[model samples]
Target chain A: MSLIQEVSSFLTHEADLLDQGNFEAWLELYEDDALYWVPSSPEQTDMKGQVSIMLEDVPLLKLRVRRLSHPRAYAVTPKPATIHLIGNINASEEDSLVMVSSKLIMTQVRDNVATSLSGAVTHHLKRSEGGFGIKLKRVDLIEAGGTFSAISVPL
Target chain B: MLTIDEINNIAGVDGMQARAYTDPDIFELEMDQIFRRAWIFIGHDSQVPNSGDFIRTRMGVDEILLVRQPDSSLRVLSNNCTHRGTRLCAVAQGNTKSFVCPYHAWGFALDGVLKAVPDIESYPGSFDIKDKALHLISAARVESYRGFIFASKATAGPNLYDFLGRMTEAIDNLLDRSPDGEIVMEGGHFSVRYHGNWKLHHENANDTVHPGYVHESSVTSARQAEGGVTPQDELVDRGQTKGMMASNGLTAKDWNAIELNGLPQGHSFMGGFYKSGLLAPQQSDAAIETYREALEASHGKEKAAKILGMDRFNNLVWPNLNVNAQFHQIRVVYPVAVNETIIKGYCFRLKGAPDEIFYRAVRFLGTLVSPASMIFSDDLEIFGRVQAGLETGSLDRLDSRRGIKTDQKNGNALQSTTSSELPLRTQSKAWRHWMSPDT
Candidate 1:
């Protein structure tokens, strides 16, 4: 497969894991040092002073996954059904790292309310063993600054 | 319009009537009597330090601009242009020369004076820019207490300090934590909306019994995570997330030990912060020690300890503000309609403290106030469920008598165990005071 095809496949696989609610498998696709960031502002530069929607390392990620799968986690009791559409895919590979940028529009429906969230998604993949592992995943939602109801699932 | 007896029936000491949360007429009256008459928190002085710097905020449901005047003072002016009544500013916050109406090009100075307008020949001779009526409306009173600003529309009422009652300690403790005695609103703010009455947020904030039942999933999840970082008895944040989640697992008996104080002005807070997570009164880290020394340098060691040792959570000012001093955060509740409310959360950065301290404040806010918070999502759900149930008109008065009998009067305020519901009863008392025919 060409480099673009390989990158696209990896991205699709990762998106599929989250969409299918297979959080355990999704957690495996990330490197131990990987960071997941959903910034509160696209213009945000410093994490130390500025707050973000979600900033988690491996331990925090595992904790979040655990919370998501909790039997009584009422946020997802009647789990939100989601479909993630990815387009405008672009990638560049250098040495041991590949950077991919894409646009994400996720539609979620639960309890008769349907909502769509769009964002600019960026992923840093490390070329390891055979395929790739996620070094970082950042999603900048267009409506990050706007008010929202409870967001139970990852964007 | 509700009768005097009807208003009395809506809110009381034992409980509150369901229509208090569902009646549009009462909501309108609340905007006039409560929000307008009370000293509502506007923002911090740190937000607008320079001339022309301004932040768009709310005073009740009225859109207002909290602007730093050219003379280095501050003014709270209605955001609507006098000509067409269109909103003067659309941006959330920024520095500006003057507010020019987008529709008719009428301009108002930072102090809300009408300075410029286009095509003066098109209007009659009666049009006068110098007339005060042509300028933007200003709040009747604006006052600052230790750098925290509040505005009131009532021409005659208690001053800001008198209205604050015991809640001033919450703001004082937040600023005194810094060695330089200064803090700024630096962290990006989070805004979340819940389909519920505005009062539900505060009623739930200081209520101690809801944590165990409302946030059971997060506590259980944090408990399952295997590590030395246990939230059960830990005083520090280890991975912080688990600590925050597990802290909610505090037994009912443990919660009962914490104290709750309800003041006469409808203000209240739950004490015993040392019992919890990152807010744990004890900081053992090297960075915290450095922060301690800096604070000690500014304030004597005894004063510093007194400052740090004072620990409480959710110091709620009546009507619509939650000041969490130990956590260096504040959540403002804005009423949109009878059933819809918007909550905005902001954190403060202490000037001389270590960056880690501010980062912890940001993290604490995210974990608890984010739209996707594991803990808050459930609360939002419960708030919605409450509004939904109340809409059915099933019950007349919801129970708030849990600790009524046990409440002890402590110098103009009522005190009870955290396991009680004294805050709601106190809130109802203030509600009746403002909503009565005499007021």
Candidate 2:
């Protein structure tokens, strides 16, 4: 496959791992220093300057994954069953670096109530020999004006 | 006797009547009597810190502009325009020179004075835009204590202090948590909707008895996660999961052992669980020293200790605001529907404290009360179910039956056990007083 096609497949596969609740496998899709961000405000670009809805380094992400999978995570007793639909994969070469943008729909179910959140996700990718691993993932929700319930998962 | 008084009376002991929740009549009355008369929290002074900066906030759905004028005083003015009553500000917050109404092109200065009208020649030179009739209506009373601003519509009543009464100490303790002797609304705000009576959440603020029960799953999980000999550990050890967290890890008999102090002006403070100090350890020392010095500077040292470490205080300032002193935060309830309430949670920056102290407040909200928290979600779920069930038209009354008679009456206020319904009763008393005609 071409470099763009290979990176696109890797991105789609990574999303599939998340939807399947295979968090450990999905964590492999990240570089050791990958950052996942869901910013608090639309204007927020840097985590140091402003708070984020979800700002996770690998260690913090590991802690969250540990909590979510624990049966005693009372908030997730039944678990938030979710399906991720990732589309519009665009890959562009910038100084030979692959940049990706896609639309995402994350449908979450908890205690018989279902909520579907639609957002645009941008992933910054660096091509490696095997494929591309995400350096950063930024998710911006369509419903930015409305209140967000506690955001525990990485969108 | 008018039906409004009778409705208010029935709501006295039962908390809020079903009619008040879904009834259009009671809501209209509340709009006039309770909202207009009482000192309602508009927004913090920090929200609009400079001249021309404004925040469009609500006082029971009546949108008002909380603006900072050129004179460095914050003014609460009706968001409505002077000409055609159009909303003056559309954005939530921004710095503006003057608000020009979109409909009529009439302009008003930041202080809400009518500056100009379109087509000045059309008025035959007889009209004066500077007249008092053309100025936007300012809130009847606007006052600030320690940077928190409250506005009321009534021209005559008790001053804000008289209304706040005993709860002022709770506000004092909150401000004193900062090493610099001040606090401001920082890290912004998080607002959520509760599909239940606003009073439900207000009453929940000091309902020390519910945490061990409604939030049992949270308390237990938190304790189990702590990996210690927790109250949850002991309860699970005794094979008593049902009442474990609800009992606050105490035995059923011990539940009756705690005190609930109801203060004057219909204010109440919960006095259980004195073991946990909400401030993080690092911030606590600096805060204490600074606060003691401040108290010595203001009052004295003995009074300062009495202020800072004086048990856990969760107090309600009359109608709409609840100051959780122990937590260094505030919950302001905006009644959207009689059955629906919007609650905004805010954390204050303790001016000269360590970042860990700020994190502790953030951690408190995240772990205990965030929507992602089962501890808080459990209580919210119960509140939702209660609101939905109340719609079935089955019962005329809700019960505040626990700790009713044993209450120590002090005329206009009362105290009971930790498990007592005194917070609800105290709020109801204030509600009745505020909803009454004389108010």
The residue pairs that clash in candidate 2, if any, are B212-B245, B212-B246, B213-B246
lDDT (tens digit, per residue) of candidate 1 on A1-155: 88889988888887788899999999999887777888899877766567778877766777778988877787788788988888889999977889999999999998888988899999999998869998888999998999989988887
Provide interface RMSD per model, one decimal: 5.0, 9.6
lDDT of 2 at B186: 68
Q: Write model 2 residue lDDT over B1-439, tens digit each, in one string.
A: 2365685666857455666565666777777778888889887877888999998878986889888989889888899987777887888899998888999888888888898888987886669987887888888789987787899888988888888877777787777756577776766455666678766776777776666566554444434442223332221121222122233444444555557777656677766554432222223455345444655555456765666665555677756887776656777878777777777777676666665456545444433444444345566666777777777767567777677877887666687774788877877777777777655
Model 1, residue A88: distance off in Å is 0.9
Candidate 2 chain A lDDT trough over 10 residues, lowest sum: A46-55
Candidate 1, B24-53: lDDT as tens digits: 988999998888888888998989999999
Instruction: Give me the runs in candidate 1 sitting further than 4 Å from their true place.
Output: B228-238, B276-279
Candidate 1 at B58: error in angstroms?
1.6
DockQ scores of all models, one per candidate: 0.51, 0.17
User: What DockQ does predicted model 1 obtain?
Assistant: 0.51
Q: List pairs with backbone clashes in candidate 1.
A: none
